[model samples]
Target: MTKPSNFIWYELMTPDPDGAARFYGAVVGWTIPATRDPAAGDMDYRMIGRSDGGNAGGVLALNADMIAGGARPVWLGYLEVADVDAAVAAIAADGGAVQMPAFDLPVGRIAMVTDPQGAPFYIMAPVPPEGGGESDAFSVTEPQRVRWNELATSAPDAAIAFYKKHFGWGQDGEMPMGELGAYRFIQRGDVGLGAVMPLMDGYPAPVWSYYIGVYDIDRAHAAVRANGGTVTNEPMEIPGGEFAMNAIDPQGAPVGFVGPRTS
Candidate 1:
């Protein structure tokens, strides 16, 4: 099983890549670089980064048919598995389902997969010559890029089982979430990979939400709303003293940025 601690790349797939790019650029303090994708019908792959020429991450408009076929606009986290084939096989044998088979790309072999209860994510084995390391985007802010991720799944047991069998992520602790009984936090060490919890009261099920690191939560939240995204949850301070704000991109994907609050 792959350790969830190995996650390095994050990607967002939406129908309106340009709009998504614009919204994130302002919220996360990244500049969208112009780079064309030959396979994407001439639509440029919008690259995000700091002004210092750091390579942040990517956003692409999914093919129209993918969206029409019941794919919801959402943020997807990609983990670097040691072996893509083994990971996909283990996912099926354990309980999860593979939405897309492992396919070769310039980076590596990747597959779209969902947990047993249908929370979607991607797994990949990076191509060797290119090697693997942290994204340059981390250079923009002191602790930039992704620092944490959480999946509020409807099926906690099945979600935990699937992830444990697939990624070797262990349960950290569980806390009561109002009427939802308990929400479980999973981790790959000290870093959070995501969580398995009941959907928030009145919230829809089976969506993966990513929490990105920023230098300032208040500024990030304000930028998100100013750039046309909606804030789902207002900025709040955690017991640890850090602050977070959850928002939705123009494509309606759940995203949030976190940073230390001023005293």
Candidate 2:
């Protein structure tokens, strides 16, 4: 399995890019620097960053007209893959479906896809062994380190199988969530790449959720609200002594962050 060092970027493809940018700028203390592709109808790209020049990620205009044809506003994870085409083929053979065929990017090739149960994610053939450009200084703004990403799915087992085939991910023992049975962890090496769990009782269909790194739960929570986001789950302790909170950005994308327990 390829070792995923850290999530390089988080992107929001939303209906209102300008509003989303303003919302996140308030919530994450980031500056939305403008970038656009004139060829794609002068598509706009806003790079999320702090005043100090750390880029957290980006936001793109979802192109409502395109959605009329069939695209949805969603948070997509871009995991680095060694070979984009090979990963695409492997994903299909393993029950996942490709939404956007592998396409070239300035840095590398990427593709949007869904797991067997429909959790969406993107894949990129990393331009460099260690992802290039810049590191997100946002981590320093929060108390916890962006630790683990968890994807709750209706078909957790199939999700596991699909990633195992494509990204060479292997599972660790499960962390039971009461009546929900067990939630499995996926890893490439010592680092926890992410997790796959059953979807909560009544939420939208399956989709990948990111866990940002934070050092203080309370501070992060305050910042989130101050920036116009909502704390869906207040800061709380998990079984293993980690503190976490679930949040929704002003644009309504599900996001989470974690830090070691303060106590």
Candidate 3:
């Protein structure tokens, strides 16, 4: 529904939603409202906001029950597909695993799925709101939104092939990462969705990491350390003259930031 295999939304599941809201508010410059609507049926969920007042994503509070059921603190992105049941069937047949069965919500039907290499993400068949429009949750050149989605997996070639078949993603130009294999860029239509690269040794595991756009990299980096987040990779100049970095949030979830080096 969303342009065939586009990333529609992102969610951060953490033990401390309030603390995460505060940390991300300072770093990514998002305006997270303190009070959640009491009518969401006791779900501790908060919608993330961009500086332009658009919906960025959502934050879900992970409880003990979810933790015991194998849920951990992680930032997961939602990939929009056309058919939830058909996609789930294809994923299961192609070595991918389904974490959550397709379920209906106020927004759409969604299911949690993992790639063949064990990196987890979501698949959704969205039902557009009253006013029909595309989601602005992911933007390559926008601040305070998801700028990139990168996957680090043990099997890049296999993962690339599998995603291509199900999601219609194609491989674009790639960058050499030496022994870690190429940073194989993935594209959907004219937009560069993200890249698939060989997983590094020190990483927690094979995972999909998203980079959030910020106005200043230095200020965002400083806020990460100041707000109890640990920097796994320091801010460095990336392609296109912007800088990016990786860090573990206070609740131990990994996140990345991409932006200009202002002051």
Q: Which model scores highest in lDDT?
A: 3
Candidate 2 residue pairs that clash: 26-227, 27-227, 143-214, 143-215, 143-216, 144-213, 144-214, 144-215, 145-213, 146-213
lDDT of 3 by residue, 105-161 (tens): 878999998988889999998988678988889998999889999999999999999
Q: Candidate 1 or 2, higher lDDT?
A: 1
* Residue pairs with backbone overlap in model 3: none
lDDT (Cα, tens digit) per residue for candidate 2, span 141-180? 2422235668888878877777776666778878888988
Give the TM-score of each candidate: 0.86, 0.82, 0.96
lDDT of 1 by residue, 50-83 (tens): 5557655667667767778887677777877888
lDDT of each: 0.72, 0.69, 0.89
Best-to-worst lDDT order: 3, 1, 2
> Residue pairs in steric clash, candidate 1?
none
